[model samples]
Structure formats: C-alpha cells, structure tokens
Target: MRPNLLKRAHSHNKQTLNNLLHSRGTSPHPQPETISGHKQIEEETLPKYNPDHWYPVRLGEVLHHRYEIVVKLGFGMTATVWLARDLQADGNAGNRKYVTVKINVNTLGEEFQKGRREIAQKLFSANPKHPGYSHVRFMLDTFKVKGKHGDHLCIVYDVLREPIDLCMEKFPGRRFSCPKLRILLPALLQGLDYMHSECHVVHTDLKADNIMMGLGDPNILDHFVQNQIDHPAPRKAPDGHGRVIYTSCSDFGEPPNEAVIASAKITDIGLAAWGDEKNTKPIQSNAFMAPEVILQAGWSYPADIWNLGVMLWDLFEHFGLFDRIDTKPGHYHPEQHLGLMIALMGPPPKDFLKRCAKASIYFDSDGQFKHPEYIEDHTFESSIVRLKGEEKEMFIDFAKKMIAWVPEERWTAKQLLEHPFLTKEKEFFSATPSLSRASTASISSMIPSRAVTPGIPPSSSPNSGPNSSPKSVPNTTLLPPRLLELVPSVSSTECESSTNCEETKTEKLATNNEKSTSRTSLSLRPKMESLVESNNEPDVEVPNSKRLSVNKANKCSQDIIDAILSKGKNHNHRVSPEAK
Candidate 1:
C-alpha cells in the first residue's frame, strides 16, 4: 500500500506487447475526482476498458463464491492478475492461504483459452521427477466468471512475489549482482531444459518480466491479506463508469533474500508452443527475436535459446542487446534489428541467408545488409565492460554459443548447463574487499598453485634479495579496483617500525569477525618477485605452458605489490631511511 510499491506495481502491471508493427495508444486525458472523492488515477489504460475487452471486477467481491479479491497484482494485454484468498482453505483471516487469480479478457479468443488449458494439462501430466519441474510455474486451478458482456476465464496460480527485474533493482546498477547471477542462471537453464525436453514446450516469450520471483515465507501472503483488510486499497469509480478500479498493491511483505531469489520460476506461458510442432507464427518480443524468427523462417527450441541470449545481455548490462528503432521514434523494424546484428556478429552466413524466407528483404544478393547505414559499429567485447579476465571471457564464450546466427548452432539447454561460465564453481566478488570463502576459492583459481604459498616466506626475491636494485616501484593498474582501495597508506611512523626499512611488508591479519556473514580477510604480499625468480630456477625445467601460466600469476601478484607501494609513494613515506 506504500506509494513506491504502488508506483512499481503500476509500471510492472501494465505489460505491453512489443512486436513487429503494433503500438498502443497513450493520448493524454483529463483527471477528475472519483465518486469516492479520490483523485482519478490510472491503472490500466482507460481506452482499453470496454465490455468486450477488459473484464471489470470490484474489490471485496467474492468470485465463484470462494476466492475473495484482496489486491491487484498486475495486468497484461490479455488478462489482469489479482491477489485473492481461497475461502475453502483452512486457516482464519491471519493464517489463510492466498492465490493469484488471472482474469482473462472477454475478447481472448477461444483458441487462446484452449491453448492455455492444454499447456497446463500437459505440464501437469509431464514428469515431475525432473529437477526443473518445480522451477517452472503452472496453473493451480481454472474456472469461469460470467460478466455483463461475456464469460471471463479465470485461472488460479501460486502467488509469486514480483518480477525478477524489480528484484534486481535492489543492487548497485539496476542489474543482478554476480552472486545473484550464479543462483539465477542454473535455475533458469534447468527450467528451460524441463520445459523443452520433458514437457515439449517452447516458452516463446522469455525475458526478465516473464520470470517471477518466488515467495519465501508463506506467512507473507497472509500478512498482505491482513494488511489489505485493515487498510483497504485505493478505490476509484470512473466518471459515469459502473465499476470501481482498485489500484493494484503488489508488495508481499519485505525484500527477498538469497533463498527467495533462488526460488525464481519461469512463468507466463500464454505464448508457449510445443517444440515438436512447426507452427511458425512470429514469436518472442521484437528486441529478443532470434534470426530465424526475424527471417520468417521456421523455428523451434533453439529460438528460445537465442531469446535467452539477448535476455542475458539485458539482465547483466541493464540495456537491450540491439537497437530495433529506425530514424523515427517508436518505429521498430526488423531491418534495423538485422543491421545491428550484422554490426555485432557480422552478416548472416550464406547458408543461413538461403534458409531465410524473407532474406531478400533485408540482405543483398551477396548476403550483405541492404541498409548498411543502419548498422552501428558495435561488438560484444566493446559492450560488456562490467566483467574482466576469466569472468568476462567465460561470459562472452557462454553467450556466443547461444546467440549464433544459425539456430542449429545454439547449444541446447542441457548442454549449456555444463558451460564453464555456469558450471565453473566461481564465487563472484562484490565491491567490498571482505572476501567470502567462495571468493577465496575464486581468487585462488585465478592464481597459479605453484606461484602462491600462504603464510610461507618466499625463498628469495628479485628486488629484496642479496642482489637488488634501488628503483622506484612501477605503476599498479593490474589490481582490481576494489582490492586496490584496501591498500593502507604507509605512514612514516609505521615505516620506522618495519624490520626491512627498504620495503614495507603488507601486514596479514586474520580475524574471527562474527558480524560479517562470511570471512573478511585481505592478504597483499609482495611475493611476485619471488614467483618470477622461482619460475627461472636453473636446475628445475618446466614446460612452456607452465612458464606462461606462472608469468601470468607473477603479473597479477605484482599488481598488488605495486598498488601497495604506490599508496606509500603518494603519502611521501620513505622506502628506507638511507636518504633524507
């Protein structure tokens, strides 16, 4: 019932259809007071309201003499979702269970309704033993409500908290943090595998919006219903309209934790189709359409993979993968989209062009884009700047396997499960230097095993040994920014206490801090010189590959030492007392 909750719900509820050619109307209209004396506020588009279009419902109204409407959750073009309590359930007001009731528009064709029912039946009949079975959401119950214009089909579902995108907004950049991404990707892939392999369903629409974050505590819904009863939702009777438009309240209780995030499920299968079928009607949101979908060629499960690829970019980068608009605003065209694809991945292959039914429209005889001017100079390497080193490499490799020009080239959901990016047991680090156990493992993997020995002094150092040079420490750009920020400034008093006045040893400390969720430790030792010398051991011969690996580790370790020295230099601390 909070204003921000209502605003976020309003933005999410009014889901629009993004396709090839259609656009919705958003003409300004006058705001007047409702019969309840409240200001006329908009929920869904007022123009969309009609007897045959959007079905009208009132708050506190009991549908089917069982489910009591509690609050509006969200609305799409075809249906409006509401939070309702099943009267048949056992508990009292504070303990009763709640379900989401999706009231379909009266105008949703009979075929659309039938398709949903069939998919639900198939999903229920499918194998439940699969790990992904629980990750994908299905209908709990289905019923009907006769309206003034026509009978509205109502489907019941387990109440989910909110969309994944809204949940990701809690992080720093309105994107999923590395830790959350690790939890999200595998679950999504499993769900996709189950939907494709077991259920034979292709979720044509796969995006952040379609994925709903699952509820953690069962009591959250009960709390929500109790709050609604205590503080009734905003009701507005439109001027001369017969029904009151209740503003949707989507907040379940509090912000979700890691468990709630991990429980996220793939939802909204209205556009889902059987993978075995060759039904080739254009599928997927315009920005996420696969090459096959855009070319008007036949598509199947692989198209979903392509959709996932684009959706990943949106999730991580906080932007769409392509620019679909032409010179005019709100005008999205396939030509422009294809042009951008060319810029990113180069022109479609000759074999791929031959397979496209509409290839001639966008591509020349030699498979070049017809509108070269529309192609922006962009590449995957240039776009993904948030990640670096192994993380960036693995991500790009994982994404390239899915966003291939040819649908067949895209890896299947099951195959993608084993991708190094997903399967690699790497724990993503945060902006903070307080490394988790998982973070330690990830960093250890980055450093070569032979190159590092914790708590042990190096045999010799290239700089500090018997033969050493008195040169200023080189620049330190290699250390990660987060790690570099932790380097303490070397004060003159602190330097005076050092055993070796020529060099400052990065003090190592271990603390049993119960306040942090994970272990907080920072070890910045200048052991890179010893690592370099060890690699050049005269009697011990090593492989060229091993040498390269050790050199890489040396460089990485050297960065930390340089960063520590640089901090000392900036503070004007003397490396040794030999010179004033």
Candidate 2:
C-alpha cells in the first residue's frame, strides 16, 4: 500500500476506534447483523432490488460503450449515482477526467420526462451572464439505457464533491459559521434567482440535501480513483435478489480548508417546476413547507424563499426551525405543522385564508384557528437562541423577509441578495500573536494591533488566512465557539480595539479535551441550556392589533407530509455522525 494511503487509512481507523469507545455505554447503536457469509451493513433496501425497479449496476460496466463505472457514489429513491471515467477522452488514465452518472429507476421512465426536459432546458438555455447561472448545477449530457425491466434515463453531470449538510459535519458542530454562511448564502440565492427569473423555474424542493459543494481540487478525484483501485468496494454476492449490491465508496477526502464555502451549487432539479406552471400540488418537505402550500393556495417562487428560510435554521442553528412531533409515526400532521407556523409567524392573514381552497375547514367564519391548543407560544426572535446581539438581529431580519405568512409578502430571490445578511461582510479579529513579552509589560502592548480579516469579498481571496482555518472554524466556515471561549484573558493589557479585547474576562466554561464526544457534549450543554431557557421564558402574547386574522387550517385526513424529513442519501460515503 502507498505510504500516504496507509497513513490515511490508519488515521481513519484510529478515529473510528476512538469514536466507538468514546463514551463507553453511550456508544452508537450496533450495526445490523450480517447475513451468512456476508457483512450485514446498511445499503439500499433489499426489497427495492426487483426485476422491474432498480437497474442492476455493476462496477467496471461501461454505459453507452463510453463511460466506465468506477464506483457507486450514492443511491436514492429513483436513481443511483456513480463515478465514471470517459473512455474516449483524449488523455492517459492519469490525465483523463471523471463524471457522475445518475441512472434513474425503470418505474420513473415516463414520470421523469417533464422534469428531465425542464432541467435540461433551464440549465442549458439559461442566460450565462446571470450571476446565479454558474451556481446552479447543469447537465452535461443525457441518454437512455434499456434494462431487462424497462428503459432508464441516464444523466451525466460535473462531479461535485458533496452536499452542504454533509460538509457541515467536518466542523465541531454540524453547522456553518456566519462568515461561511455569508459567503454561501448569496451563491444559493443567486442560483435560485437564475432558476426563477432567467429560466422561469421554481425549485419546489430547496433544502440542504439538494445543495452540493463544487469540487475544488482536481487531485481529490484522482486520490479517490486511486483508493478504489488499491482497495475495491465490498459487494454482496448474488443472493435471493440475484444481483450484486456493492457498498458505495465515493469519498473525496476531507475538503481543503479553502473548499469550505468555496461554492455551493443547487442540484436535483428533478422536482422543480416552471414558475408560471400553475399547479397547487403539495411541495417542499413538511417542516420547510410554506403556509400557501399547506393551505392549497397558489404558490410560486416565494415558496422557495420560505423553504430557504426554514432551512437556514438547519444550517446555522443545527436544528429544524419548526417542531415535527406528531402522534402518527412517519406521517405529517397539517394541524400540528400549521400550529408551529402560527407560533413563529403569528396567525395567517384573513384575506389570504379567504383565497385558500381549504380555508373554511381549518378556520371558522370569524377566522379564529380551530385547534388553538396545538399552537406553541413563540416568535421567530425567541426561537432563534444561538445567535446574539447584532448578528442575531440581522439574521432574524433576513429570515423575516423570506418566511412571511403571505407568499406575495416574501422577498424575491434577487431582492434578498441585497439583504444585510448577504451584503454586509462580517469582520473578525485575527488570531492573537503568540509573543513573549519582556519584563512585566502589558500583554496587550506585547501583541501587535490585531489585524481585521475582512469577510471574504467575492471569490478573489482564495488563500486568505481566515478562510484557511477549517479546523479552527466551522469547516473553513466559522471560528469554533469553543476556541473563542479558550482565548485567554490578559490582565491590564489595554487593547488597541474593543473588538479584540471585549471578551477578555475569564469565563466559567467547562472543557473536556479527553475525548471528542466529551468535548462535543460539554460544548453543546450551554447552547442546549440556553435553548431550554428561551423556550421556558414567559410567552409574550401577540397583541390583537398585530395578530393576523387568527385562524388555523384543519388537519388533512391523509398524511401528505413526506416521511423522513431529515433522511437523505449522500453521494460522498463517509461514516455518518449517527453511525459513529
């Protein structure tokens, strides 16, 4: 084995072992039992492997007699993504490029055509000059493969590294830093703007799972292919299903610090529809769904804004903005969902409700919500506890513009790009200079005037120092709050600037350096405590003057909310945090 590969494997194993033994009795759930003569591990559901469903994909199998499958990247409900090498490219093996091939399920042959056409037209025909055009994932090529069950559509795309949510795991907490969000949020909005304005498309499903990070270094792909060549992915021998099921092994390795928030592209336009396409079909995940969608009112680009707003909590706060605990298991409760919405956004507007098809069912003639008990007494400002001071204020202001109860009230993607959260760059003080002071001089005087590392202005500063501290920040994203807490206090040192020295007093923070789990647990305690306190605080009732025509939508009898709101199939195959 190559020395670097061996070292990486050793380090990975060490980390795995360490995580396994992290908290003794508190170790993660055991893996599923292996079948006889085979490792029983988590992969695609065995039941899905049928003659008329999944296309039996094999490693090294060349599709269309041109692209050779290298390894399984990921598997989803309707398709499987694989890394493939172009056999006809004009280069040697080492110099040739790779592309991701998404083979759709046989069952989706007819249903996926509209989406496929829109994806191709919107991405390819979009104005190249539109700033968001580049941020949106576009198709390189498309074709069809005839399988034994039926025909399957094959889509070829540029090999993006991983999804935004997966990238968040590299940080101490699974969240992006403010600076990183400042960089990535605009790119996402720009992409949305391009889809909405230039392409006349509305991404019905806009969440972390659909947003992927652009590949930064070409060498990462080379290493992945080399790793596969050295150690082939393990596969289950043909059993009752009579098809080999190979475990996915698509890892681009830990992204270089600069790659964190380098660029985020909106992928998976499979569920997207044209903005002018008038359809009230239920869209967006339950928690992120807009009120207009749940109420069966007409929706358009604003729905995406609402989806993005709710998703922001997941990205920055490490939790869903709306609570989703219903009596039914793996089902959506519309009443419960609406109650949460009412709490954050206050009651929906009476005028808007009048236009809703099912408004009467949820609300009385007077516009009072029928199930007022389900409502949680909270506001957007109170629900957000992680951020504080001006940062918190700016975030709430930005969110309010997107999550308005009325869809028309929501800001357009282009207008949102100019918000303070996206426009104003957050500034941070540089790491303190570790200098040895002479005599008993002030520690502040010993250190040079702290330099201001400006929040990245455009994509020009790729090699900036602040942008290179992924380990210290949230995946080259944000400065780890834990590290900021550890900044030592120097007595009597007059700081040149208040930003550098405001938090000089020693804080009574407990730290555990023994194990990662311990550190994670200890570090999260304060945040959780703060969250609990915020929840327990006295509920400030929304005054009658401010409350909208107070009403609730009656719960739909059928469970329409998609099951497993947070569940996602990742292209990059790393040990998930839950598995660890």
Each candidate: what lDDT? 0.61, 0.59
- Candidate 1 ranges with C-alpha deviation above 4 Å: 1-43, 46-51, 92-96, 239-241, 323-330, 427-580
Q: Please write out the lDDT profile of model 1 over residues 212-297, one tens digit for every residue.
A: 77777766776776676666565554334465666666766566676787777999888899887765688887788888898977
TM-score per prediction, in order, is 0.67, 0.68
Span of 10 residues, lowest total lDDT, candidate 2 = 1-10
**For model 2, what is the alpha-carbon lDDT of residue 531?**
13
Candidate 1 achieves a global lDDT of 0.61
lDDT of 2 by residue, 1-580 (tens): 0001111111122235655675335644332111333334223454344546667788789999889998887766577788999877755444237889998877774656866786667677769998788889888888889887788889998888767777777754557756556667877888887887777788899988888887676567778877877666555544555556656655667742534454678988888886776668988877777888888987787789899998888887856788554523367778888887788777887888987888787788888888898798657767676654434545666777677776655556766665534533222111133211111012111111111112212121222243443122111111123322323222222232323223322442232221122212111212111111122333333232111111111121112111111111211112123212
Our tally of clashes for model 2 stands at 5
Model 1: ten consecutive residues of lowest lDDT: 526-535
